[model samples]
Target: MPDNGDLRGVESTPRRDAQVRVFAMPPSDNATPTQIVQGFLEALTSDDPQYKTARMYLTPRAAENWQPERSTTVLADGPDAAARAPVQDDDEHVAFTLTGREVATVDAQQAFSPSSGEYNKLLRLIRDAETRQWRIDIVPQGVVMGQSDFERNYMSVNKFYFASNTAGATRNEPPMAVADPVYVRSHVDPTTQMVRSLLAGPTTWLDPVVRSSFPTGTALAKGAGSLTPDDRGRLVVPLNGKAAEVGTGRCEEMAAQLLFTVRSPTPAVEEVELRSGDKELCSLAQESAEAVATRGSLHSPEYLYFLDEDQRAVRIAAGSDDTEPEPVPGALGEGEKQLRSVAVAWDEHTAAGVAVDGKSLYVGSLVSGGSLGEPVLRSTGKTEADRLTAPSWDARGGLWVADRNPAAPRLLLLEEGAGEPMEVRTPGLDGRIQSVRVAADGVRIALVVEKGDRRSLLIGRIERSRPDGGTAERSPVTVLELRSAAPELEQVTAMSWTGDSRLVVVGREKGGVEQMRYVEVDGSTPDIQQPAALTGVKAVTASPDDKVPLVAYSVDGIVRLPSASQWQKITKGTAPVYPG
Candidate 1:
């Protein structure tokens, strides 16, 4: 364990086990107040003081009913004498007078430095006066200490009770009255001090609740029913409809319920079987299954356009829609290919979709191939490359395609009515383009490039007046450094922009944990905030207003976070889908 530093010791003296009796009387009119006060003074000066003169006798008791060992450093002359001689006059005594008589006498143990000793003497006087014998025998039941103001008001009370009998008292003498019990829950990610959720029970049950003291980024789940750790050590919460999936990490037991929406199944039905990596997971219902795309429009609602069992091209619109559904378009003609991935322009005016037919990208000894003769966006005839690796839409309604066959990947810019696309070169971007996003203003473009497993983010400015009609000027903004000794983050799964222009990156860490991070474009250190543990995260899209992010996890259903505080379940019945 790392050394944090030495522990601090308590300033007061330790507790002791010896029991001592002291006495005092209730003041009355007939008996002069001075007479009552004189009684207390005489008790302290008696042949033997009933209470111990050591400072340890004045320290508060511990909760476990155990007294701390008495300190050996008690003042030689005692706290009273050492505390006041320097400030006291020859004829003046350091004492308290009740009415006109000195009921309690105090002495400074150390004359030169009296503050510490004076405090100790004052404490003893108060203790002795409170526990003194009453005209009625009120036993010295307990000793209570408090702030100076609290002590003043408390001492004015006409009655006293045994502190140990209080419902919440942890010790014989409680400083204050018992208070109502309250439950506090907080979720924090240690890596990034981002507070995923904090809630006080009963009022904020729907908010994510994380345990205090647990490592940051720890996943938590709370609901109406009880949560128990499963055989696999994962925390499981069973809902009314089905079992809800929770992120994995340290689990804390708490009392709170997260609100979730439960929905009835739709009427549409079409069963189509599919295979992923040779494993049969579930049968897809072409007609019945609905695809809802977030941040998408009617023209291009499908961020992920897939062919249903009926060979239909279905587009799922983004956002919440209550409109009546319509039949999806049948698969494109034999000459037209299926789109594997698509990218839309920042202005949403243009888009480029890519499909591969009968070709494969080599990765070690693994041979991966897509459908052959797939209809992909026409590429610029800059090089005689046969296939397009990834395609994106530029700001000016133009399409850019990356030809990956050649060692040097070429960028082709295609215009609306161009017969042959124009090839454009960007300085300082030597790696293969993996993903791209157009800036908010449509004049700047951000690209994610990869060299082997290492990735780097590069930004480029579009120049229309260049000699070649269009030019891309590489900017100095380098968003992410994928190559680090800490841990290698795998494939870039999703990217979105917050309202403030900070880029959010979602990917898998070396341990296969789905992680989310943010990097400000204005040049600041990256803040990587870990979300709940997830197996396979297929799609991550932000709301148009950037207030919420809807993440679709494979086999875990859809999780919706309206804000950091509101985690809602938006889907029911259907299991999460995993892509090949």
Candidate 2:
């Protein structure tokens, strides 16, 4: 028990008659942090029910001090002090402050009055009137105790009153009942804790006052079991056995009953069996030879190649048990006259070949000495020359050849049975011709123009026929500007036309990465889709079918279209299609 004599001086004051009442309860040995704070709140506010009126008795200096582990003391002494003190009687008031080991006394006239706003702001400090038994305000000196590490050593002074027959009487008494003793546990201040109650056993023991205050049998109803921390800070339950598993997976049978408690339901575990008996369930064995063979033959064609040569073409057709190329006698240019090179025409009937002389252009016939007909020969209107670049016949049987001459670099479109060869002039194309390919539509021809050190692939369309009716006028149009796209090309070795007028030019890019860019000539921005970044890509040509664009390099031959996936190796060594 506290010394009641310490408050005796204030009780005998002239202006006010006061009595100090004190009550002390033994602390429970197993009392939690929450229970201690809750018990304190209930003991303080047992008499005063309205919290708003109860706040007026607290002084401002006491409320402002919040130092942890240190005791705060407020001496109520100043002008208007009597008005700020708690009213004890009709003609008397009382003033008090907490000090070291004692609650000190003061004259009512010397007390200070806090502002109305300040008094109302102190309402939150009440916490829960029904749970925590105490409502406290710390004095200035007491605030330091809360600021220290040993704050639990200090006890808060909470004021309370009891109803009496006398005009003013102060007697501290524990409330008749403390409801819902749950405290908001914080390490900072014990007075600011919340209040909660734990189940003593499986059943509830309600206070008689609460039972009578409400309807009959209301207090006897079973209350919910709350999750609370035990002595070791591990969360445990007040109830044992299956009742302890309310929110856990073991309570699956009670799922439907507590459906509303499904906010954070426990997770379920799925069991998987790896083995059943002693026999191997999932074995790790070396793959059998037969199984490897089945997997290898699953793909349609392991290797695909183009039989460009006549002799090799016959062999590839006979070697494969799969579908073979139809043997149309007049389908492809045939017969042996020492065929040096063969280029597939964009259209079927018009394949052009060159002999060992490299001058005369053979269109649709490989007979020597004009055995089949008059062969299209290259001439500068000076002499009929034999040495020539690759030859290609257009859809109208007009033979187009790239003549090797700097002074008169010409792309001739000559008539097969005509009297003299006609010159098809392309302005701004005076350089030597490296390669040429007629477009699939047969209206335009793609040419690789070499001027000095620079090389460009130009698409030339046959604009008009010659005035003498001997050759067509070929005007060169810049489809892909090689200087802008690939500036480091020493020479454009090969060119091919993909469908939709997209020219796929294979040449050396800036960093020496062999590049292939598909450029659309129909006035759209060129989409430079580099299929593969490879080296030594010498020549590229699209299949006449256009459905499959086959790209043939020096090392790897016959690459497919769409995805440009690599095909089986054709030649063992790297050799040019027409080797010197």
Candidate 3:
């Protein structure tokens, strides 16, 4: 139906401003005040360094005082509602109010944390007498951007810190390093930004539980710019000469920290070489660093365990050789005691469970003919919803449980034997904890809390306090510093700590479907991988090792992902569990 096969007018008309490139356009001599403000906002989305060109929209005096690095405020879409037409009072004066919801904030130190509430930024514009163009005169101290622009402009990288490797660490376990997540500019070399954030210190949330082996005040040697590796895949990091004061053991530890942190974003780096000025101080190969710096390395379990239709614990062989489900020889596995949830120890030597009746927690050995111990913990909840949650065991052999009894909710830690369970206080907790999963480091606990009918995921740091009196004083007591870790997620149903600082959680955004995704403990961003394909998931479990596939319970049966080519059904199971 086109004349002369032209077909020029077949489509509908495009938007008037569709071809306009706001970021590329500078203020014309006759540009209005609002146009200048819009241009400035668009320029912020560019990858330009120091925002030199963007500064051209501002008066020289305002440009000299405005500091974008002081803070960053993230806003939602439809920034038009936040923008206003400038009201001019005089030839040189105009003002407008820019409003938005502050989703997150990046401080001057580059630490990213969740922040909420409506922010109203006052914009004062002035007409330059010389150029006869509108320029930003007085603005908020920080930069404001919409969510889409924020995601495209900023990225996240994790800095590594080590557990204390000093004299008191348990001999059975190799030294381990934990990850601290931070946000930085996506255009800049993340390797250098990550290293700089590493030197600055851990975010306040993780500062208590993690420690950096790099000595205090340690920094990149003066004159060094970005981090880059040599032809041999060796990343050479130049530290200020102050590092020379530490001994060889300390140097290796510091190298391990750098090796893990740098290799995270730059997988091409095979080894890390630490230097003071021009002198090489130490070097650590990836293999050697893995022994000391890695956490949650993959080690397949002897069997993939879950609860069968009979509410009994059962096991199926893990790895290539898939086997039919079989009940273990222990009492808990025999179905005499009904169970609602279960947890297994890393050694596969012990198992813990919550009774179906919702009042008792039992711990027993997994070995054949092993007797089920007496109920080590009992819940005081009066309702089914208030009953005991799933129990978890830390690497140190301590069992943890949350009794969501509305009358007396508490998080209790039970020792291996029949020792009295100590109540772990979660300070700053404003709601009842529905579930708790302790990290392998034994210093962080992932909790699902219910506040005002909404469930939120939280990370709490476990701190120990010793008696001040004598060497033979009372046993140390553990306390929790609880904080909201995932403000972006509105309703979190179930969660599992998969790595040092990553959690795979089943949650839904406002008015969205319930789905599973990997989120950092700091809640700065989601994992790069798209949320895994899963449906009808009632509960999910994953091994501490990230390489292993995740296990989940759906209406069909128990299923393992990517491990069996598809969601292979294991059996009619309820709760699938793995060692922490």
Best by TM-score: 3
Q: Write the per-residue lDDT of candidate 1 for residues 197-314, one digit (tens) a residue.
A: 2211111110111112222333322232323223432222222211122222111111111100000011121232211233332332322222211111112223322233332233
| Runs with alpha carbons beyond 4 Å of true place in candidate 1 | 1-313, 321-336, 344-351, 356-387, 417-419, 468-493, 498-500, 508-512, 522-533, 551-562, 565-580
Model 2: lDDT equals 0.34
Please state the error at residue 113 of candidate 1 in Å. Answer: 56
lDDT, candidate 1, at 231: 46
List residue ranges in candidate 2 displaced over 4 A. 1-335, 344-347, 365-374, 378-386, 406-408, 416-419, 466-490, 522-529, 543-546, 557-564, 570-580
Residue lDDT tens for model 2, 339-429: 4445433223234555545555555522223233445565343332324666655434455676775456566666542345566666655
Give the candidate order by descending lDDT. Answer: 3, 2, 1
TM-score of 2: 0.37
1 or 3, greater by TM-score:
3
Model 1 residue 376 lDDT score: 33
Clash count, one per candidate: 35, 49, 0
